[model samples]
Target: MSGPGTAAGAAGRAGQSDALEHLARVGLIAYGMVHVLVAWLALQLAWGGGSSESADQSGALATLAESPVGKPLLWVLAVGLVALALWQAAEVVRWRSGWSASGDTRKKAVEKTVKAVAKAVVYAALAVLAFRAATGGGQSGSGQQQQTTAGVLGWPGGRWLVAAAGLVVIGVGAHHVLKGLKKGFLEEIDLASAPPTAERTVTRLGQVGYPAKGVAFAVVGALLVYAALTFDPARASGLDGAMRTILDAPFGRVLLTLVALGIAAFGAFCFVRARYPERT
Candidate 1:
């Protein structure tokens, strides 16, 4: 009787684990879809197409809203993204518990936890955005960013706070660039079963995509800094605003187009991630 109960408990736990993994997989695919849409919007702008929206996450959701059966898709995306956030949270907890083999270094565990936290925040935000879209309360991510900046700027010593935020964003951008250069993203992916050609393609895509995203983030940070210095919250734009700023610069079209292409490459890499996510 004791052995049967134990077996039943073990099977239940395994089923739960399987369910969570499936949810995470769907979440990853949804994440990839968002990136791909963002890349498409960026490309449209690069080619001189007119758009009233920013090339950010909100923009991507908005684009999806315009499609047939958009609402249902948004609901699905929201569910998946929320699951992904939970997955990241689980990773953080696991790292905190030192669940890995003794060979794993403390430094590596810390790094992984930090990365997971960041991803959790992002995935949660995306989930909220998707839910809003599904419910017909969709809002612009860029606009929301500006509002937040304005609120922050209204505080005492607001300028300093804004400046600090800008610096943090810049740091994040630099990290992205570094990760790309170092091919550190490969650490998460399990490519043992992949063919050499597929591996090479994913590698190339990541190399271009990460740095390209880094550049965009850097631009956004600069704009935030500019806003802080100028006492203008309007200048504190989001990803879409950053792309516009790039396009408005000298040879802006060419520069933006190049960046757009890089972002698109990153989006392609996201698809690969969806198919072959990193194993713990």
Candidate 2:
């Protein structure tokens, strides 16, 4: 009879399947498309024109849903995202299984584990959202975020909890900014296979894209902190709210335009990543 070790070995092999890797790469394309749409929406908001679409991932997915082949595309995106999530899950398992044998320091192992876990959660959530959009049961992420904030605020010490959450988000944003500025993202890409021009293009896109995304997230975190302090959930709107807030500032148009372009660059970078991912 096959024992646990035999079953585990089989499972590990399955997780490393080439088919799954291909699907995950396709999922990266879907993710890039979402960012491109968000950039378009943000530009519209910056110009004081365009429909009432929210300038965030939900809005991007909604825009996709309204296209001629929206539902079909969403289904594909959903499947790809699921595959990506599973890939991350496999990475987490590998990290755990090889933690001691890998010869890496404890800190490095922990960091890799954390990053894999985070990616798994994010990809899984996006997959669910895509599936919901495909099924005509989609809801606004910003609205949901606000509602969750409101509910939390109603609990004892909820304000503190919200503030803590906001701080964590800010920290994440700062990390992204640092990663971009430091070219840390290149560590994950096998640029050795890319042509010189392609390498330059991808590097530039990541450098610009990371900071823009970081700025947006930082603004969102600030809004959450403001909402907690004021005891008002309306102030806790997500990316959409952040864009509007930027619009109200001096030289808002210029700033928003730059940020939108940066987001677009990031989206383009995703396409390159899909094609040139580092092999484990």
Best by lDDT: 2
Taking the tens digit of each residue's C-alpha lDDT, what string does model 2 give over 4-103? 4455466477677999989989988998898999999999998877767799888888889999999999999999999988887777665555455544
Highest TM-score against the true fold, candidate: 2
- Colliding residue pairs in candidate 1: none
* Every model's TM-score: 0.89, 0.93
Off by over 4 Å in 2: 1-12, 98-104
How does model 2 score by TM-score? 0.93
Report the C-alpha lDDT of model 1 over 1-280, residue by residue, as the tens digit. 5553454355335424767768778888788788778878887887867776579888888889889989898888899898888777777766654434366576677777788889999999999999987887856877788899999999999999999999989999998899899998776567986678878988998999899889999999998999999988889878998988988999998898888888888878877776777744
